[model samples]
Every structure is written in C-alpha cells, then in structure tokens.
Target: MTSDPTSDPTPGSTPDPTPDAVPPTETVRPDWAGIDRLPTLDLLRLMNAEDRTVPAAVAGELPRIAAVVDAVAARMARGGRLVYAGAGTAGRLGVLDAAECPPTFGTDPALVVGLIAGGRTAVTAAVEGAEDRTDLAEADVAALALTPADTLVGVSASGRTPYPLAAIHAARTAGALTVGLACNRGSALVAAAELGIEVEVGPEVLAGSTRLKAGTAQKLVLNLLSTAVMVHLGRTYGNLMVDLRATNTKLRERARRIVAEATGADRDAVGRALGATDGRTKDAILVLLADVDAPTAAQLLKASDGRLRDALERARHQGPPPA
Candidate 1:
C-alpha cells in the first residue's frame, strides 16, 4: 500500500521540521509582521517605541555591572588589560569602545584590546563563516598572552556564538577573568564565563536584526563598564576627565578650561600651570590646587598612585609648599 507523504513515519514523531526552534522571546514578533505595510510615520513611531525600552533593560542590570566594574578596576590597577572579543556588530562595538579609550582616558592603545573573529576586514563587511570558527578565537586569546591580571569581555547578541564562547574558555584557561554580555538569558556564552550579564532586550522590531535595541543595550552596558572602571581607577577628578590626552586643538582648549574649572584658577595661571606640566591636565591641576611646583606635583601624584584626591590630601598634610 502507498503511504501518505504528510503522514509521520513514527507514532510520536513531529511533522514540523523545526521542532526545537529558538525560544519565542528571541523569535520575531507577530505584531511586527505588518511593519512593511504600515505608513512611514507609523513605522518610525513603532521603531522609536521599541528603542525606548532598551535603557530600562540596561538599568536593571546595574548591580551586576557595578560588580564587574569593581572587579575589573582592581585588576587593572595591577596593570591588567581589558580585552573585548566577539563577532559582527558586537565585535565592531567592542573595537569602537577600545579605540576610544586612548584619547578619552590617556590609556595606552595596547591596554584595551578588541579582537573580532575575522580580524580587521570583518568590521565593514561580513566574512563568510568566520563567527563559527572557535579555533580562531582560541588562537586570538593565546596571542594576547592573558594572565590573572587581565579581564576578557565576550559580546554576542544571540549568546550562542562560538567565537566568543571559545574566547571566554581560552581566557579562563589562561587565568583571566571572563565576562559575557548577551541579550538572551541562559546562553552558553554566559554559562561559560566567570560573570554573566544578560540584558534581555526582547525580540527586535526588525525581526531578528539585533543591531537595533540589542545593539543599543550592548553599547550602554559597555559605556557603563569602561567609564565606571576608568573612574574607579582615578582617571576622573570630580566628574572631569583629568586623564584625557589633549591630542588636538579642541582638546587643548578643553584642557585649559578643565584646569581653570577644577582649581578655580585664573586663565593666566591655568595657562602657566599647564605649561609648567607640559600640558598634562592632572599634573597641572595638582600644581595649582596643591600650590607646588610641577616636579613636586608629579612626585605627589606618583606617591598617591595617580589619585588626585589622595594627592591633594597628602599635599595638604605637608602644609604649604616651601618658598
């Protein structure tokens, strides 16, 4: 007898091919199915509404983020490096944040490293199958020569990307702290790392395109992580970026303003103090606030481990600078 094509061969077999599909939370929303048919204004409004939820989702993870930042700061104070590894949009964001560290916090370029699955070429265009290569991730971590002092952050929107998972494992094996940032909960990437940060931004408005809300969530988390770490490491003085490297005309002007604002010093004194310190903002601030020569300010800063507050306190305890 001929069998029906639609009939299941086994008694308990499912006819649907994709039985173990992605969870509904990660799958595309049925409400957004008609987005293409909506008017331009409505479409824009809908997308904007979806974007608004991202920040709250990020805010919910603040306690965890703080814990990671504190841990990273302690390690970094011991000369540890912050390394970010991922693929695709997540990778690009990591690279962008790493690149910005130098000018923003006067960090050495090598101090915060970003490694993408396909290297530099994958930043602009997708490389075929690069994200699936776990070996490449292992090799990249090995090249960094990670130690107990370093912290590695693996970013993946889906949380199942092989590249970052492997990188996390490799980093852990090398005695480094590992963190996983993903938009989905209970992901393999999160399970493998020492710390797991799942933002849970929900399904995308564009149906699985995570570069929208998920990407924004990642950016916000990264901003918090790096900025908080920098602040904890004494890179900032009273919300001012004292460690900024003034590499351009605008930054130089900003540096002078920062000195004036920080110490309540006159413009002329700011200029003179900055000149005395060779345009180093932190040293200039110390020179003005501590009432000491540039060299003395440098020594005090070194003694205080570059903490402006501690240096000021020590300088105050020593009384006024000798005439």
Candidate 2:
C-alpha cells in the first residue's frame, strides 16, 4: 500500500521526501547515538577524536581562504576596512580576532570591525532569538557606512542564520565585497555572497552544539584569513610581527628582541633604534638594517608604502650613507 505523503517517515526511513532537502550533517551523527551512556573517559576520548578532524576540514578550504585573504588585502591597501558580522559563537570569534589586530598588526581600531547580532550584550549572554532577526543585521551594516573598497565577512555555523544572511545582503548593496563563511555546503549564506568558504566539519559529538568542532573550524579559518591578509599588507618582516604596537612590558621586550634579531644589533643598539622610532618595531628594524638615520629610514618606509622589504631594497640601491 502507498504511504501518506504528509505522514512521518518510519524509523530509519527517509525523513524528507524532497530530493534537494538534506539534513545538515551537524544534526545527524550516527556515532553519537549512545553517547550519554558512555563513561567519562570514553566520552572525552570520542570528543578529542572528533575534534582532530576540524583541522583537516579547514585544510581542504585553504585555496578558498587564500583567495579571500588576497581580496581583503587588496581592499585594505586602498584604505578599506575588514568587517565581520555574525551571531553567538561566530560573532564572538570575529570580535576576538578584530580585538587582537590593533596590538598585533599596529592597525587602527577602526580598520578591522566585528558586529554581533544582538549588540555588545550578546557576546557574553545569549540574546534569545537575536540570530533570527534579519532587521538587526541590516541596521548593524548600515551604521558602518560601508564602501566599495571595504570587505565584509559574514560567519554562521548553520550557514542559514538570518542575521548573517541579512548582513551579507546589506553589505553587497553598499558596494562592499561580501564573503560568506559557513560549515555546511550550499548554504544560503554562501549563495548570497560574492565569495563563499564552506568548511564541512560534519556533526557535533553532542548533537547540534556547534560550539564544538564547528567553532574550532571557524577559529582556524579566521586565524588564517586575518594573519595572511596582514602578511600580504606588509604587517610582518619575514614572519616577525614588525608592525606590533608594544603597549605593555611583555610586548616592549618583544619589540626590542625583534629589532635585535632582525638587524643583528646589540641590546644598546636596539634600545637606541627603539627610542629613535618611538617604539615602532618596523621603523627600528629599518633604521638598523638600512644603516640610515631615523629620518631617512622613516622616509624610505613611507616611500615604499610601509613595506620593509621594499624599503630595504630601495636603501640598498641608494648605496651606503655618504662615508
């Protein structure tokens, strides 16, 4: 006998009749069926094994991540900002990454921006259905005053969150380059943006709790995106964070070490250079490596668009300071 189309599918049968409708892997994990009965040790082991798969998933999306990084760097070089929008874990991750940029890359606080769906309060406590509010996302992007030169990245673990989808649409309308980052393939978030990065991390061991492996994958991707873009923008000198703003004791010591290591200069020489450049690590390195005075080093850096390697080459071509 034929079955009723509207009736629920029997256990182990197809849940949805639509061929194009597939359940998100995040909501279906066969291995987690008897997880509640497992011992604490075994549960931890299972979680760890599942967590190990996150890096591999991220690795598969490296090419796409590289593309986004290059695009973001190009825009940033033209005075554009990198903006990230999302909700919950995704939003917190964006905020954390943006917060680190200032001290890590010497970027202005306004350069990298993170907008959460429920505003500041959402970062710590859940805002209750804020992720489903598309209007809030639109308002957040509008307040940014986006331009064509800016790049906006919308992050969502489900890939169907209304907040990020709305932000992506609003950002695109403002002529900003939009990138959608999601953990599921063929998501609305991905389809709506000019560039999409989907890292399929599969199901969570705890069932629907995306803050586990999915969160890890998002963090990994964000790390690569921001770090690579900064590297492309000359924020580093051969893997060293030359653009670091040494605001505290630890960073101040790091700045001195970076200068000494980059220029083979002694402690006193590093201190002198740091003082001359007002604790600017890149300028100190340039001053020492180019064997030029502070003013000349600053000029060379400015001429080369703050690229240390380019400034060094220019200084080399100019020959040694008049003996």
For each candidate, C-alpha RMSD in Å?
6.8, 6.4
Q: What is the TM-score of each candidate against the true structure?
A: 0.91, 0.90
Looking at model 1, report the run of 10 residues with the lowest lDDT sum. 10-19
lDDT of 2 by residue, 1-323 (tens): 12355776443232222334443645767867999999999999999999999999999999999999999999999999999999899999999999999999999999999999799999899987677677888889999999999999999987877788889999999999999999999888899999999999888898778889889999999999999999999989998999999999999999999998899999999999999999988889988888888888888888888899988998999743332
> How does residue 255 of candidate 1 score in lDDT?
97
Worst 10 residues of 2 by lDDT: 10-19
Off by over 4 Å in 1: 1-20, 23-26, 319-323
| lDDT of every predicted structure (CA atoms) | 0.88, 0.88
